[model samples]
Target: MLQFLHICNLALLDEVSLDFEAGFTAVTGETGAGKSVLLGALSMLAGNRVDKTIIRGGAEECIVEASLHVAGNKQLAELLDELELPPCEDGVLILRRSLHRKRGGKVQINGALATVTALQQLGEEWIDFHGPGEPQKLFHEKNQLALLDIFAKNSTALEAYQADFDQWRGLWREMENLRTAERLSPEEAEFLQSQINAINEVDPSDESIEQLERDFKRLDNARELGQLSEQAGEGAREAAQAASRVLRAARELAEIDPEADALAGRLDALIIEAEDLSSEYEALASGGDFDPSEAESIAQRMQTWLQIRRKYGPTTEAVRAKRDDLVRKIGSQTNVEGQLIKLEHRAGELEKSLRKQADELRRRRLKGAKDLAAQARELLTKLGFKKADFSIEVETENKLSRHGHSGCRFVFSPNAGQPLMPLNKIASSGETARVMLALKAVLAKADATALLVFDEVDANVGGEIGAAVGRELAALAGDHQVFCVTHLPQVAALARQHFLVEKGQDDSTTTVTICRIDEDKQRRESELARMLGDRDSKSARDHARQLMASV
Candidate 1:
């Protein structure tokens, strides 16, 4: 569960920190009081993208951090190990995110630097968010199928089907590529072959190309190099003679004065260096003589190498890669018919295997759909959907898809005698919210996420129905920590923990603050009374007290 949340320099929130526990926690505030700011903080913590404009005015960055108690979650432990993040100590995992104005943003897991993707992967295991917009996503068939799969516990089956499908798709693409190559015109084939032959004739390698370049330069500048070598050798010989003469003089002086021995040693070193320089110059002068016949051959080879580089690559490695690719394509063109027959046979066998696995998937979905609908219908009664008729229709298709050969749709009729139709076609936003809550209530145990967040899920619900929504949320809290952002006093009255968000401003800036009021009965009542329309009214407070007592 999320044990602590801290936000700094985020929008209207300069800084805020809250500690939470396992239970249904209600967050209540008037419109524009910055309740959404709290949701925004959680969203950023969940690895959602954020803009720099969300930073508080005059602030350089915004930060969101959370601490979770994950003592016995084996799944989270394995994920942490797989991502190479630091493991929990004494059942605590810390996640931190910071967004800067100019430097972008960064995510951290347990103090170890991590990517937003890693944070998201880990977040999925610990937190689940159901905001107002999330219910709309349920209208899509893909989301419906995914929910069914979760209920069915189809991980193993799905993995098997996906692997086989991936293999079949690869083989299919390869066969198509071969067919395309086989369809090339004679002119195209000739052009490709010419490119291949050019590279093959050169037989370029990194080391060989470098040596060829060096030899070409050396042979081309042979005459000029020979003249310079002679001049350098003459200069070195003269410098050596001069250093030798000075050393002899210094040696004579060293016999008279011992300090002069150091000078003689320095002159001796200079003479040795000059002699080595002269020897190198002499060697270069000798090698500078090149055979004309050899020079012509090297020049032609060098020109060919340059032309190949300009056409196919700016480097030898690129040239080699292009050559290999052309060769492979030509080979495929030559034996395309034979390879196509073999690949087609393999694809057929794999497609049969895929169909078999997909059949198993369809069977599981069919079974899971019935069970899910039955369970959800039972919960819908508790959420004030007394006569709601809900069912799932699994439609199987003839072709394979990324998911499977079957898709599922959520069919619903909100009232008795109403014709059942697709959820997106008939259900209102309020109905959708309640339906989603029912499904979530049914799947709470199957969901491993420790924290469940509902941002204004009771958007259009009020009065007794709101009370029922509160009860359902409270029930969900029996096993998971649940948070609801709501406006209903009845809902607020039932929370094990209640937080009040208030927007305040001094002359210079505005800020939103949230703090727990569950410990103060009068304060809780006052907040609930405010939600009832008038906090100062004695009657409202009395009603708030009564609501609290009933809960």
Candidate 2:
């Protein structure tokens, strides 16, 4: 339940605070006395779009804040938890909205920064505002389906159907895309085949390219290499011969002198090393036959690599990647006939399941629709449409959707002899308001989280009918918090709490002020009476006294 509301710098309301109770609350004043301004402030807190022009003349921003005591509302608590917002420590949820004159604004829930969408979701759970010019929400197909679901208590089943429907829809779209891809024109198919053939002709491999390049370099420089190797071999052979001669002379000298023997041994080692070097040089000089034809082959192979790289990528690895991708696409194209068969079978199965679930849902909704019509008719009779008839038109389709195959349209007839027609087409704004109110009252038990706000529900209604509207609102207040803005004395008199919105001027500024009215105060009753009739008339006072006494 809403506990308090504080507003500042909104329209003519400079500053005001209203304390509310858990039952029916009424705001009453003369026309243009700022009652609607209060509702506008509440609307802001409820996350409605803000018009910056509502800012007061000297104020740069308008602020609207509300405190709701929701200790018993587990659903709201769960929502707060889901959003990761700090819960009301003392069971008080504080919502504040600030709108600037420059079309900027901020929203806060329980002192935590929140998005407008989040605020709106929370507000929908907490309030429902019915006013003139408010869109006819009941006429919307989605809302009608939601109402039917609520009546049938089929949330779980509807959720299951919706989940499956989403999956089936996704798969259907994928199948369509695959079919389109598989239906490529012959020219497109030929182009793709040409690309594949080009990639396959080069047949490039990582190490194969590197190894071939190495072999080509060696073959290209074979002549220079062979000449260098011959020169090295000749040098080694000359050194070996000279060392052999020196070693033979040293051995002869070693016989004459013992110290010469060590020199002779070192000479022998040098000759051995020279001989090994000469053998290596000789082997290298004997180069394998260098063929010009081999070089031509290498050049041709390199040309092939260059062509492939130019057409596809800079490297063999990149070309190979493209080849793999095309291979997968070709495989999918080859298997398309089989894939289509599978998709058709799956779609058939899904269609069967959808039909069955839709039929079950339709059964529940049809039953719920009858009950809803009966209830609405009963409430309409209470609101002075004694002979009105209410009905729900369920038109079933052969397709599947999240809301099943049935479309629900509410129809109404205001008089006994009149033909029932679509509610939106037949009911006036005032009549719609009352009908919506009646539906809300009936749905209150199931819609315990929703707060119903009625603006001029008493429009075009008076006397006992007005009193019945008041009684209905009062009754709705028993299960849900009710906020009503009214000009009717009967509705105002039914409020457990009443507020008087009055406009005042001080110096250069005009301000709207709200004050809570004590029901025991006769002056407040007289004021409401004046609003209903004439202020100074004895008859009005007497009638006001009677109204108060009856309440």
Candidate 3:
């Protein structure tokens, strides 16, 4: 239940703080008294979308805040916990929304920054707003099925069935993909096979290709290389001969003079070095002969390698990778039949399971529908629709839906003589409002939420029926908080908490104000009379007093 609301700079409201309590509350005022503005501000607190234009002319921003006592709502507490929001102290949940003219808006739950989606989710758990021109969930077919499931308490069963159904659908999709792959034409298969064979015949290797390349270069320049080596040998031989002749003369001189032993030693060293050089030149000239046949063989092998490289890849390693990929693809194609068979079998089993579960769910739903129709009929009778006929039709579908194989349609006849038809087709706004109220009255016993707001629920209702509507709302307040915006005085008289919304204007500005009424029964009677009739009417005052007393 809402404990308090503080609003500032919102539309015609400059600043106001309202304290709320449990039970039925009513807001009553003349037309154009900013009643809708108050509701709009409250809606913002309940996480409705905000527009910056609602800010007062001189204000830079607008703020709407609410404090709720959520002691009895464990579901809402759990949701807050899931969002990692701060826990409520003394079971109080504080929600605040602020909108700025320049920057965007911000939302806070329990003083923690929260996204709009998170706030809206938490708000839904705490409050439900029924406003004019707003679509009603009960009238939607999907909502009708969900309501039946809730009434049956078959959520677990329904979830189990849906899980199997999803698995079945996934398997079916996989089977379709496999079938499509299998439908490839013979030309495509032949093309793939040719590519695989071509890659295999190349038999390329990185090390082998590198060695071939080196041999090809050497062989291609064989004539030049041989000439350079021959020139080098001739140079070494010429130098060796020149040194030998000089060493011989030096040795002879040394022999003739015994005092020249040091010079002779140097000559002996030079002789030895010249002999070693001569031997090296002889080895170089005598080394293996350069054969033109071997060179031709290397060139031929290189040409073969180049041909393969140009046709397949720029490098031998790239060709090898492509070959591996083709091999894997071929293997997959060869085993595709077996995989298809396995998937088909799995899909069949899942379909069986899905059908079994869906059938069981349909049975439970049928039973639940019977109970829901009976309850709705009873509730409608209490709301002054004495001869209204209501039924929940559960039609089985060939395929599985999220809510199993059953589709729910809530059929009704507003008058005694009329045949039953869909609620949307048969009921007027007034009849629909009453019907929705009656459903809410019944569902309230099962719904655990703390607050429910009805915006102008008295749209097309008046007279004694208005009092009955008030009575029903008052009864709902026994266990839940009810906020009703009404024009009918009979409904207003039943409110334990009464508020008056009055709009005032200055020279260039308009302001809306909400005032809590704390007056005597006589004063309330005078106000009710004003609501019922023009200010100067004795009969209207007497009638208003009677309406108040009756409530």
RMSD of each: 11.3, 4.9, 7.5
> What TM-score does model 2 achieve against the real structure?
0.78
lDDT string for model 1 (106-180, tens) is 888998999999987887777777765442446678877887898899988998889889999999999877766
Query: lDDT by residue for model 2 over 1-551, one digit each (tens)?
Result: 88888898889877878788888988898888888887788778777787788988889998999998888788888999998888987888999999887766898999999988788778867877788765455767677778878888889988888888887887798789887774556676677777778677656687788887777777777778788888898898899899998887899999999899999999898888888998887787665345668777777777777787887788888999888887777678777878878888888888789888889989999999999889888999999898889888888986777788887888888888999887667557777788878888888777665467888788888999999999999999999889898888988888888888888877987777888875557767777778768878888888887777777
Error of 2 at 335 (Å): 4.6
| TM-scores, each model vs. reference | 0.65, 0.78, 0.67
User: Which ranges in model 1 have alpha carbons more than 4 Å from their true place?
Assistant: 70-92, 100-106, 112-125, 133-140, 177-339, 412-429, 505-509, 533-543, 549-551
lDDT of 3 by residue, 1-551 (tens): 88999999888888999999899999888888988877787678767776788888889999999999988678888898899999998999999999999898999999999988888888778887676654466768987787788888888988888788788888878877777764435677677777667555534776767787877776666556566666776676676677778777777887898777688787667756766776665565544334668767777777766776786679887777777776676676777789989988998887778788888888998998898789889877767687889888999898776667778899888779898888677446667777777777877766666887787667666786788889988998997899888888988999988888888888987888887873567667766888888646898888877877776
lDDT of each: 0.87, 0.82, 0.79
Of candidates 3 and 2, the better by TM-score: 2
Q: What is the lDDT of residue 426 in candidate 1?
A: 62
Candidate 2: RMSD over Cα atoms? 4.9
Off by over 4 Å in 3: 47-52, 71-92, 112-115, 176-334, 416-428, 505-509, 518-525, 532-551
Full candidate order by TM-score, most accurate first = 2, 3, 1
Error of 3 at 339 (Å): 3.2
Candidate 3 C-alpha error for residue 23, in Å: 2.5
Q: For residue 301, what is the lDDT in candidate 1?
A: 86
